[model samples]
Target: MTFKYDVIVVGAGHAGCEAACAAANLGSKTLLITMDMNKIAQMSCNPAIGGIAKGQIVREIDALGGNTGIVTDKTAIQFRMLNRSKGPAMWSPRAQSDREKFIHTWREIIENTDNLYLWQDSVKELVIKNNTVTGVLTNMDVQFSAKSVVITSGTFMNGLIHIGKTQLRGGRISEPASYGITEQLSELGITVGRMKTGTPVRIDGRSVHFELMAEQLGENDFHKFSYLDFEPRKLKQQSCWATYTNEEVHRILRQGLPDSPLFNGQIKSIGPRYCPSIETKIVTFPDKTEHQLFLEPEGETTREFYLNGFSSSLPLEIQLNALQKIPAFKDIQIYRPGYAIEYDYFDPTQLLHNLETKKIKNLFFAGQVNGTTGYEEAAGQGIIAGINAHINCHGGNPFILARNEAYIGVLIDDLVTKGVDEPYRMFTSRAEYRILLRQDDADMRLTEKSYNLGLASTQRHSLLIEKKEHINHLIEFAKNYSVKPQYINSGLEQLGTSPLKQGIKLIDLILRPQLSISKIAELIPALHKEIDKIKNRKDEIIEATEIRIKYEGYIDREKMIADKISRLENIRIKGKFDYNSIKQLSTEARQKLDKIDPETIAQAARIPGISPSDINILLVLSGR
Candidate 1:
C-alpha cells in the first residue's frame, strides 16, 4: 500500500499525539502511524500527570492549543496544586487520572480531528533521499509518503526489558519492540545510545490490607489541569496508601542484586538518578533504614494499584518476597512484576532549534527519542516539532521560544545547546527566569503566539485578550486605590497579620507575603466586586495577579538580564562558519564548537568550557 501525507508522525504516545495534533491543527495533512491503535496515549508508567516543573510545561502545552491538559482534566479522578506552601513560582497543578480514560480521551480527540489520519502498523524505516526524509516504510511493506516526518517513539526502539536474570524483547508489558528503524538510522550515520527506565509492580487493590497503611487523600480544594472552563467531575476521589520498606525488603532486593542487569554489568545504559530502583536506593542510601512506598489506585474500577516507590527489575520471586515485607502488602496479589527497559535514543544536540535533524531535512524527532524523560517534557517537544515541521513544509520560519519565555523553552534550549549525557528531566532550577515563567500565566504569555501560528482558535484568542485587559484594569485599580486603616486594619488583625498604621495602595498591601488578593477583596466591597467579575478564572489568574504585585521588581530585573543574553541569541552564526580558522581559540573549545555546530553565539556560550576568550574570538570572526 502507498499513502501520502504532508506530515507523517510515528508512534501515538503523548509526544506523537501532540506532534500530530499540532501539525494537523495547523492545516497539515498529517498521518499518525502507531503499532497498536488501542494503545495510543497509554500511560506506560504512572497514571498521574504533571508535577513540579513538569506541571508548568503541561499548562504551557495547553495554552499553545495542545490536548494534554484537556485530556488530563477530562479523565482526572483527583486534582491538587503542588507546592502551595512555597512561593507563587513553585505553585504547580497536578492530576491523578484514570489510566484507561486518559488514553481513551486522547484517542477520541485525535480520531475526531480533521486532516489527521491514523494507521495501525510499526514504522520500519525512514525513506530518506539526498539527506531529506521523504516518507517512511512500515512493517507491512507499505510506503507512506510525506513532505515531513516526526518520530516520537518513546522507549520502543530496540527495547529490551529485564526482570532479574530473565529478559524479554519488548517495550511495555506486552507491547512488541519496534525493529528496523534503529538499523536504518545507524546506516544514516546517526549515533544511538541506550538508556533504561523502570516502573513499579501493580498489585490487586482488593487483596491489599489498606487499613495498615496511612491514607493519603487529595487536597480539599483542587484545581483542574486545563485553563479552559470545563465541568469538574464530582466522582468520589480515591485514596492512595503509604507504606515503607523495612530491612527485610532490602534483604530480599539484595539477593537479586548479583543477578540484576543494573549491577551485573549486563546493562550499558544509564538510569535516571532522580528515580532510582529499589535495589539502587538500598545500596546508595544504606544508612537510611527505610524508604517510602505509595500504593496508588490505577483507576476507579480496576483492582490494580501501582507500587509507586518500589520500582525494580528484580526477579519475580524476589519482587513478591519484598512486597510481602511491606506493612499493608502482606496479602497482596501481584498484577504485574516491575522491570527495566533499555532503548535507543539520539543525542538531542544533533538536532537544530526547530527539532529538525541536521543530517536530514524535513525529519524531526521528539519525546524519549530526544533523551527527555517525562510525559510532559516529551509532549512539549512534540508540539513544537509538529508545529515547526508543518511550518517548514510551507516555507515559513520555525517558531522558537526563548529560555525566558517558558519551561518548554528551557527544555528545548537545554537539549539543543547543552545536550544530555543522561535522560533530561525538567526542574525549576533548570530555568534562570522561572519566577517570570510561572504556571498561572502560561496562556497570557504563549496563547498569542499559538494564535499567530494558526493553532489557537479565534475564541481562545479573544478570551486571552479579554483576560489581559481585565488583569491590566485590576492592576491599575489596585495601584490607584488606597486602603485606609479603618477599612483594612480590622481584617488584617483578624488574620493575625500586623495591622496597618497608615493609608497605602491596595496593591502594596497585597504584595505582603501573608495577604492574598481574595483576602483583601473580602475586606473592601468595591474591590470585591471587581474581583467577582473575573472570579471564574480560578486561582491561576489570582496567583498571576498576586505575583505581579509582589515580584514586579524581580521580574523587571530578570527581564533586563534576559535582554542582555538575548543579544547574543540574535547574533546568528553562519552555517558555514569555520571554527578551525580561529587560531587563538582553545583546542577544546574549537573541537567542541566544530562538533556541535551551534547556531548562535548564545548557544555557543552555553556549551561547557567555552570560555569568555573563545566567545570574543567567535564574535570578532562573525563581525558581530
Candidate 2:
C-alpha cells in the first residue's frame, strides 16, 4: 500500500502532535503515523504539564499557534504560579491535568485540522533517495511518500524498561517498543546513544493518608496557559500533598541496592541528574535522613495518584517495604512498581538549527529523539521541525529563533551546538535572558514570526498587538499620574515603608516592594480610572507593566549583552570550513568544531571543548 503527503510525521507523542499541527496548519498535506491512536499525546510519565522553564516554553508554543497551552487550559484540575516571590523571569505557570482529556483534546484538534491525516502504524525504516528522505516503510510494509519527513519517536526506538531483575521490551509501561529504525538510522551515518529516565509508581488514593501530609492548595484566583483572553474550562479544583521519607524508608531501599538495575551492572545508561530516583537519592545523599515527596492526583474521577519524587527500580517487595515505612504510606497499596527506561537518541549536533538533519535533506528529528527530556522541550523542537519541513516542501528559508529571544531558542541552540552528554532538561538558569523570554510575554516576542509562517492566525497577531498596547498604556498612565502625600502617606506608613512627605508619581509607589500596582490602582482615583479602561484584562496588563517597571535596569543590561552576542552570532562560518588548518586553535577545539560544523562564531563558543582563545582564532582567521 502507498500514500502520498507533503510531510510525513512519525510518532504521535507531544513532539509529533505539535509537528503535525504546525505542518498541516501551514497548508501542507501532513500524515501523522503512530503506534496507537488512543495513545496520541499521551503523558506516559506524570499527568501534569509545565514548571519553571518548561512553563515558559508552553507559552511560546501557544504563541506560535500550537495547541498544548489551550489543551492544558481546558483540562487543568489545578493551577499554580511558581516562584512568584522571585523576579518575573522566574515566575512560571504549572498545572495538574486530566491525562485522558489532554490526549483527547490534542487528537480532536488534529482531526479537525484541514490537510492533516492520521495512520496507526510503526515505521520500520525510511526510504531515502539521493541523500534525501522520500518517505518511510512501516512494519506492515506500507509505503508513505512525502517531500519531507519528521521523526519524533520519543522513547520507543529500541526501548528497554527495567524493574529490578526483570526487564521488559516496552516504550512505556504497557506500550510496545519500536524496532528496526535505530539499526536503519545507524547505517545512514547517524550516531546513536542511550538515555535513561523513570517515573514513580501510581498509588491508590484510597490507600493515601491525606491527614498525615501537608496540603498544598492552588491560588484563589486562577490563571490559564493560553494567551487568548477568555474563561478557561473550570474543572473541580484539586489539592496535592507533600510528605517525607525518613531514615526507615532509606534503610529498606539501601537494602535492595544489590539487585537494583541502576546500581548493579544491569543498567549502564545515566538517568536525569536533576530528577534522580529514590535509590539514587539514598545512595548519593547519605547524610540527609529524609527526602521530600509530593502526592499528585492523576485525575479528578480516578483514585489513581502519582508519587512525585519517589522514583525507583528496586525489587517489588523492597519498594513495598520502603513505602510502608513512610508515615503517609503506612497502609499504602502500590498499583505498580516504578521502573527506569533506556532508549536510543541521535546526537542532535548532526542536525541544523531548524531540526532538519544535516546528512539527509528534508528529514528532521525532534523530542526525545533529539535527546531532550521534558514534554515542553520536545514540543518546542517539534514545532520547529514542522515549520522547517513545511518550508522545505514549499521552497522558503528555514525559521530559527535566537537564544536571547525565547527559551525555545535557548533549548534548540543548546541541543544542536552543545549536544547532550545526558538527557537535557531546561531550567531558568540555562537562559541568559529569562527576563525577556518570560511566560507573560512569549506572544509579544514570537507570534509575529509564526504568523508570517502561517502557523499563528491574523486574530493571534491582532490579539498580541492589543495586549502589548494595553500594557504600554497602563505603564504610561502609572508614570504620568501623581498621588498626593495626604492620600497615600497613611497607606505607606501602614505598610511599614517610609511615608512620603510630598506628592509622587504612581510609578514610584509601584517601585516600593511593600506596594504593588494593584494596590496603587485602588488607592489613587485617576490611576484606578485609567486601569478600568482595560478592566476585563486588568490583571494581565498590570502584571506586565509592573515587571517592566521593577526590572527595567537589569532587563536593559541583559539586552546590551545579548546585542553583543548577536554580533558574534551574525559572524557566519562556512559549512565546510577546515578547522584543522587553523594551527592557533586548540586540538580539542579544532576536532569539536569540525564535528559540529557550527554556523556562527557564537555557537562555536558554546561547545564544551571550544574556548575564548579558540573563538578569537576563528574570528581572526575568518576575518570577521
Worst 10 residues of 2 by lDDT: 220-229
Model 1 compared with the native: what TM-score?
Answer: 0.98
The per-model lDDT (C-alpha) reads 0.88, 0.90
lDDT of 1 at 559: 90
Per-residue lDDT of candidate 2, residues 1-624 (tens digit)? 678999999999999999999999999999999999999999988888899999999999999998889988888888999998888889899999988888888899999999999999999999999899999999899999999999999999999999999999999998999999889889989999999999898899999889999999986453668877378557887899999999989898989999999989899987899899999998899999999999999886888899999998888999988999988899998789899999999999999998999999999999999889989899989998999999999988889999998899999999999899889999999998887888988888999999987799898988878878888887888789878888877777877888888888878889988888887766677877877888445687678888889888888998999998899999899574788887888999989998999998989999997988998888887886
Choose the strongest candidate by lDDT.
2
RMSD of each: 1.4, 1.3
Model 2 accuracy (lDDT, Cα): 0.90
